[model samples]
Target: MRPSVCLLASAMSSAKGMSPGPMALLPPIHLYRRLLRAHRKHLPPEMRLLGDEYVKAEFRAHRNVENPVHMIGFLTEWQLYAQKIEGDAWVGERLDPGKVEKMSDEQLAQLYELMKAIQKRGTEEGQDGS
Candidate 1:
């Protein structure tokens, strides 16, 4: 068996006699790692940076949490976020007029930064074509 699968099986067996916990449901560290990987693979540049930073901060803050309920809730939320990004349900990079109108000032600023980056790249490409 693969090492990870072996490890998971071991963890599951060990937790069999205990009350159900986040670890019993799924390994928290593994879930966190997968969430980060999903963010990197699926999010746009600016959103990726923001998402990664937020995930890192949340994981770090909750590193020592022992409450299974809180851990499960946290993991569930992050898992859904990762799935949405991977499924292309998140439209962070798309500047839909309705979405743009609802964005907060910080989100608008991030969008502006992304626009600037795109414009810079286009200008460079045009200059190269000359």
Candidate 2:
């Protein structure tokens, strides 16, 4: 096994209730695969297609990131999103107001674009009755 996976496994096995710390995070490839798997297993076909594409693009865009903090934050958020999907807890949930307030303008713009895409897809799906 890769060193990162081994570290994650050891940390998980050793730390029952507490966090396993930063080094225990899943590597980017592992996290990406997990997210794709979660979407495949849980999402409807159209949503899964959109989600997989988005995840792939985002991972590709971030692949050359040199800052560890930004990379860790990105992976951690994606991990949380995957867990939410796997647990069926993402449905009917709204973005938290506080979290929205914390977003930078660029992040907000990306979120707005995503919301528009989702609405567009929803409208298309409604028309298609699928």
Candidate 3:
């Protein structure tokens, strides 16, 4: 058995009012660490920093949550994202024009701004290197 599974089993056995289930049987901190490691290997430096910060903030915000249902949802989403990153399924900042057309004006504006910022940073770096 995986160390996480063992830890989860031990935790469930000791905690009152908590039963073993698939989600509950996966140790979240272990999973989070795995996701971070995967990100380090798969993501570009800027994107990795952003993703790591976002994940850290979200986990910290939910650290005190006692609702198992919500916790499971959060873990499931993050796990899927990690899997996508590790599988090389993510292409950075490249949305289809058709999909962009479907976005709300505010969303489009935000995406445009982000793209511009990334481009500007790249330009600045190129200038610095020369």
Best by TM-score: 2
Candidate 2 residue 126 Cα shift, in angstroms, is 1.6
Please, what are the lDDT tens digits per residue for candidate 3 over residues 19-80?
A: 64544334578667978998899988876776687678777776766665556556766776
Candidate 1 lDDT, tens digit per residue, 21-55?
44333455676788788878876665566667767
Model 2 global lDDT (CA atoms, 0 to 1): 0.81
State every prediction's TM-score relative to the real structure: 0.51, 0.80, 0.56
Which scores higher on TM-score, 1 or 3?
Answer: 3
Instruction: Score candidate 3 by TM-score against the native.
Output: 0.56
Best candidate per lDDT, number?
2
Q: lDDT for each of the candidates?
A: 0.65, 0.81, 0.68
Error of 3 at 79 (Å): 0.5
| Model 1, runs deviating above 4 Å | 1-25, 92-130
Global fold similarity of model 1 (TM-score)? 0.51
Task: Report clashes for each candidate as comma-separated counts.
Answer: 0, 0, 0
Q: lDDT score, residue 130, model 1?
A: 100
